[model samples]
Target: MCRTTLTLGLTGLALLHAGPAATWLPVVRRRLPGLAGAGDADHVALTFDDGPDPRSTPRFLAELDRLGCRATFFVVGETLARHPDLGRRTVAEGHEVAVHGWRHRNALLTRPGRVTGEIARAADLVAAVTGAEPVWYRPPYGVLSAETLTAARRRGLRPVLWTTWGRDWTRSADPDSVLATLAPGLRGGATVLLHDCDHTSAPGAWRSALGALPGLVARCRELGLRVGPLAEHGVS
Candidate 1:
């Protein structure tokens, strides 16, 4: 293979396995604030990503209300735009919204200007439709490039990633499987990642998340910890 091809292939592998952006990239990591109270042992941040999806998001919201637990919804710019009313309802229901990039494109492979510009633009779109600019940002697929991090800072948003996740984005994920994966990571100040929409994931994967929500919330309470949005964690 040509040197250029070899370099590109290796870079893709690195970006995929380079740990979480908020921790992996030093330049960006410096500006990124780790979720506060992540070590508090009595608080956990329940964050749902890639949402404001009309079909699945409303279901997640309904479940959260039923369980009396609150969560942060990291919404996509395109999805929110397509379903502005859904975005409005997500905020109106007392959930915090954050940017998840425009159309869920992978920042690592995207151009720097595009990455940075979209961050600002998505922030604007979210703010205009949701009645507030998101104070936090999570990259699409949770993958961030150096420029994406810079863009996050330029937009005045904090970058965050989870301590653990449900793996609920997979088609094989079921309620029990989701709970099993997440329960081990349950603790105060832990950030739990789960997808509210599966647009970028396995089809119907959102069902596993929705099915897992009640038990997850109950488990948190039973452990004497409270589940809340990232804003509640004071990371924003």
Candidate 2:
């Protein structure tokens, strides 16, 4: 290939890998609400990622029960495979189970074929373990490549990113900080992202999210927003 042609090809390839990640931007979320998991104006979608952990996921399940709320748990396939019972329990408890990829690796860094296989594997494990067909896919780190989108489509999983996140993965995070970080985006139609386990986070970081759950649900109810899983969020 000529120098100019090769340059153009490289640029196009780069865009293909990173372009869709623009959805993570606020302007993109405003423009493509469905992609951002924005749903009914009177409801907020609650989602958790990197879970099915026996060490901490059970606690989240208990807390959700106490709050009388249902949230979506996006499980890593490898992790869920080890704790299939936990996956089943999440669904049995009235929560939704979705795919968070086979592992917590970013698609941007994975080869297309590997990303494709991992997504499919994760989706299959979710269905097999929970007996519920997963409906959504959230790439690790909220980064999406062209391959990630294609894999999700092929598996019939709608790609969703959060409208707001608790930043609770940090060791420094606390209930107050998680709530405050999410305060601005705590609105009707927002998809709230949190972690039920700390597999890919600081040890015990999940506690921050756990601590914030009651207050988070309360604040949403205070604003007249129904808090529930994405399945009930009415996302397009």
Candidate 3:
């Protein structure tokens, strides 16, 4: 009976930790606009994850500069620690740097206290490198657990998930494919997810997202939408 009780308790804990992950569902995201990163009707929030990589991130920076647009780069803590110059450059380039956790591991699968500590550590690293406190936190793979939410709150970071993604991490992804995947949801008030590096994806897959930048920005302008970072997105 003791073993049975212990098993039940663990299951309950897992459920509680994973329940908020339901927000990943399209319907749930549509209903919870704020959590889904919905913002101003005339603006679109451009967010990139798993980055500050030396291999591919600089190319993304150059592309954004060419387009005259800025985006939020959700960087991994450990990666940023290794490339503090990249982090500094990101900020200096008129882009916003946000937390993508200390590592890219999902919060639900991380051991207790690990996710919490990492969130704080990552936020601190961003502040240390950029000299500005990051205002947003996006969990790796968009999974948010109970502890993840608590940690974010304690750090004064607001959790945000994207409304649409380019699926640019796939091995088959390319510029046109990335644009096509994101086309349906490209609208004002939509948060579009792209990746700046392939740290957790098919090697060199970031090219798809990089190649799509110009077209994406052009398409948004055609729709009379403004492309910028989440700070300008007016999330409320």
Candidate 4:
């Protein structure tokens, strides 16, 4: 009976964790009220979230520089506070820096006023670093509420969503698996979601998503896809 209970508990936890990725709303196809669909042309936009880490972001930027690609980075305000120079470097490298919220908080859980504060504060910080307010906002974990969207719009930012996600937040995520997840929709106008930072800390630590970069970029090139900044596709 105890073993059975343990198994059930583990199964429940697994389902709870998997629910977010499976049920996340696809915001890419949903048109915001005010924006016109100029649409993307012959290119895919690469975006990274929950970032500005000191250990991993520099390497990610270096790889982007080497590949001659520019990506959109959605940075958390608190993390930006901790790594201000890294945020500056991201802009200096010609990548777009957008807001991921303050403290990586779930937008759904936050009150409208609080959400406004979180987004506005983050946008201000990003502007301070890069000299422009962020024009795009991607909610943490892809969770959103109507209030979140309204607040973002009022701030003059558009809610940008992903066409593909790698679940790169997982420590056990295989680079090949990440590649496979993104293989199908990797045509023009695709926004690929990845992470430049892993919050986990361990000896000989792994940055699972960052590990998948070279493989993913090579695959994009092999398919004759252009990878560039999200703004180029008129995402905002």
lDDT of candidate 2 over 1-236, digit per residue (tens): 12332232233343333122333347447766787788999999999999989989999999999999999999999999889999999999999999999988766667658989999999999999999999999987666666777789899999888888888988899999999999999999999999998887889999999999999999999999999999999996
Which regions of candidate 3 are displaced past 4 Å? 1-23
Candidate 1 per-residue C-alpha lDDT over 48-132 given as tens digits, one digit per residue, 9 for 90 to 100: 8888778889999999898888888888887788899988898899998898888677776776588788888889998999888
TM-score of 3: 0.90
Q: How many residue pairs clash in all the candidates, one count each?
A: 4, 0, 0, 0
lDDT of 3 by residue, 1-236 (tens): 22332232234343433222333336436556777789999999999999989999999999999899999999999999999999999999999999999998866678999999999999999999999899999987677667787889899999888888888988999999999999999999999999999888888899999999999999999999999999999986
Per-residue CA lDDT of candidate 4, range 97-209, in tens? 99888877555455657887888889889999888779888777555556666677788878766777776666556777777777776666678878887752232122556
Better of 2 and 4 by TM-score: 2
TM-score of each: 0.86, 0.90, 0.90, 0.82
Model 1 scores worst on lDDT over the 10 consecutive residues at 1-10
Each model's Cα RMSD: 5.6, 5.3, 5.7, 8.1
Candidate 3 contains a number of clashing pairs equal to: 0
Better of 1 and 4 by TM-score: 1
Model 2 TM-score, 2 decimals: 0.90
Model 2: ten consecutive residues of lowest lDDT: 1-10
Candidate 4: worst-modelled 10 consecutive residues by lDDT: 30-39
Pairs of colliding residues, candidate 4 = none
